[model samples]
Target: MKLQVNIQILQLSFLALLFFTPLLHKTISSAPFAAVLHLLSANLRLSLSCTICTFISIFYYFYTRPSQVYMLNYTCYKPPPHRKCSYQVAENFVSRNAQFTEKTLDFMRNIYLKSGLGDETYGPAFIFEEDGVPTLNYAMQEAEEGIFSSIDALLLKTLIDPQSIDIVIVTSGSFSPTPSLSSLILNHYILKPDVKTYNLSGMGCSSGVISMDFAAEILRSSRKIQNVLVVVTESITLNWYSGDNRPMLVTNCIFRVGCAAALITNDPSHRRVAKMELVDSLRTHDGADDGAYRAAFQEEDEKGINGISLTKDLIRVAGMSLRKHIKILAPRVLPLSQIVHYAYSVVSAKFWGDESKPIVPDFKTAFEHICIHTGGRAVIENVARVLKLDDEVIEPARMTLNRFGNTSSSLVFYELAYFEAKKRAKMGDRMWMLAFGTGFKVGSLVWKWLQNSSQEFDNPWNDCIQNYPLKT
Candidate 1:
């Protein structure tokens, strides 16, 4: 409506200019010199006032415009050696469990063998102890270790003080304890009394990217320069399922302990030290559709034990969600050449028969590096197949999954760590981070690397990175 009003006003102004210009010319030519001079002086004064007002408005708009968000640094927590779960250790725990029947044990074992996880992935304290239980205390302990360690390292790396943080955002896929994770961070760090906080739960694996997007929005809209500490982690101790439901057993084989923390700031002074600048971000939710909503759901099995089921329709739901998401995102990030090619393909396909499929846009053309979510072997392969990504392009994701397992929302950060370990990303490089969650939601973060990638002391892959890009 505002645009329409502006157009109508422009039209009226044009018509008035046409109607009055000839009369004004005639008046100047025929009227007395003094009268014409007075009229011209009045017109000049009006025009000058309008020009001054326009300049003032433009100045105000620029002064009050939103600030650009930047990522100062990030760290991914590495569990202690004692907490590492080898294949033998995992098998022993499952075999010794009374809850698992021989059939269920066999099913879980098969899933583990194909889970694309390495022998050194870490589990929660409960899984490492002989008689340890998946109690609430252990869950909190797991959260504390992952969250605090990553945040500590991130603060140290960025040289950011706790009291200076203005916003705190924490996200956990399936864990939400009473003193919410955000509150826990506040108390643990003794952050500023007025620090804003948000605890996000039930957002699934994509929550990391979602939280980053959330932080970017906050920084952009804030009145004053602010710093946001985004903590992305998952407490898998309590979520460890003992039920025998086949559909729900995948989590047991894939999920593991992981956490990541990043410090994002809108302070222009830190731009020189920032790793990446928030370029463009997009999020799409297809949960309104029944299949997408039920793709991965938590429910009780026949025996009344609760577990989250990974339905057979999950792969399809992910593909569908990606299709819908990129429709909106492709235009924003893709170069004009690529967008035009894609548009032509799409428009041409509609004119042709249904047999002629619309050509998929080459996302590689837009992003120099992509951090695909390492949800599982199948999920990674599926994303690669859909995007036609090269093996080298997805090596970071594949390696991170092998090393860390599915750390839920934190997986993408681990992949970013992998990129740094290999020194693959350079200054001015465009990076894309993509992840899918339980709500069948897909989230994307487009980042421009402000500095060349450098492996930090806390990089999760620093020790084992040399052996990465392993055999499939």
Candidate 2:
């Protein structure tokens, strides 16, 4: 119906142009003006006719195109052999440390044990090596190893040649080294020279979702089918804190090394083998305010030691940012009934002079599954409270946190892998991925499962799927 309207508009516009050009030509009697008008009208009519035919052709070409964007496949990095940081080993590493005061050591231990982290989470740089001194060389090596392995697995699983990727996006919140992460992928894969590449830094943990939105928008606007490879990872090797600042101390306790790679494409041929279809995405930022901006800040401490400081206001900021994000997102995804109820509540509260706050819409009605960022226990709990979610709904986030720790930008993909491993996602089910980043930014992506996913060999949970949902 819409296409027909556009076609009709083109036809009408062409007829008007053709009719006016000749009528104007006839009205001009002077030789000079008449010839000029005649030439102008002839060119105008010809151009209009060409444009009309072009529009018709282009519309017909697209009208027959497939209607889905596919996430062909994705893989989360499983840290190489012997890189795992179990609780006992982490405690021992702390015990052996001469830098932290006993009081600070105890605090770190408390956060580590209770941070929803498990024994399998991996650390970067010298933290995992036999010797515990970090070096720039070692940090780069660790980053490269993680990126290569993850991307290799993703391409292998998808059976896509590296040369086939047309776009590359790499995001790491804290660490972006020389020959940028995207450049590293280009050099490693030897992709085509014309491949467009983007390196996004300082976008925080929500960058994974941001990258997805970035790729989707680009693919949607492009005339030709294209594949975008998005690599989401964080650099823990160089960001490690040796400082005693309490806020900075918490980062050391919770964050671990992780990376994830995904292949997203607008190519209709790949939809048959894709896991999910990108449905919708939204992002909201609250960093304009000082408090929200400083909630999770990175800077050098008094001694000039660099690290991210997780201020006490972070959880509060997260809650506020999420509230703002959902406000815009609800209208896009929520059903009409729920939307009407929310509207009535708002109207009643404002006009009726009711003191009660407006009702929170039931997001459960919008999506079958939700992948909330595993920022920490507090962040997860706060999101659950705001959304009024049940324990089952938050299980993936909790389990992902426990198993992988805070993987920075790549966290949500790990949670999605968990859902696939558990076989919780089925064809036609809608999944909402919500992630919070250090810029105090909130991002959301909605996806519809294209097919039922079974356990894949590269699944990080393959070894211990049976042991999940650990009692808190």
**Which stretches of model 2 miss by more than 4 angstroms?**
1-68
lDDT for model 1: 0.88
For model 2, give the 10-residue run with minimal summed lDDT.
59-68
Superposed by TM-score, candidate 1 places the C-alpha of residue 342 at a distance from the truth, in angstroms, of 1.3
Candidate 2: tens digits of C-alpha lDDT, residues 1-472: 4467566656666665566555554566455666565565556656755666566556755664334577999999998758888898788887777888899898899988779888888887587566787778877887788789999888888889888899999998868888888998999889999999999999989999999999988987776889999999888878778888999999988988889999999988888899999998898888789999999999999999988999999999999999999999999899999999999999999999988988999999999999999989888999999999989999999999999999999999899999988998899999999999877799999999999977999999999889988876
lDDT of each: 0.88, 0.87
TM-score leader:
1
| Poorest stretch of ten by lDDT in candidate 1 | 1-10
TM-score of each: 0.90, 0.87
Give the C-alpha miss distance for residue 156 in model 1, angstroms.
0.9
Candidate 1: the clashing residue pairs are none
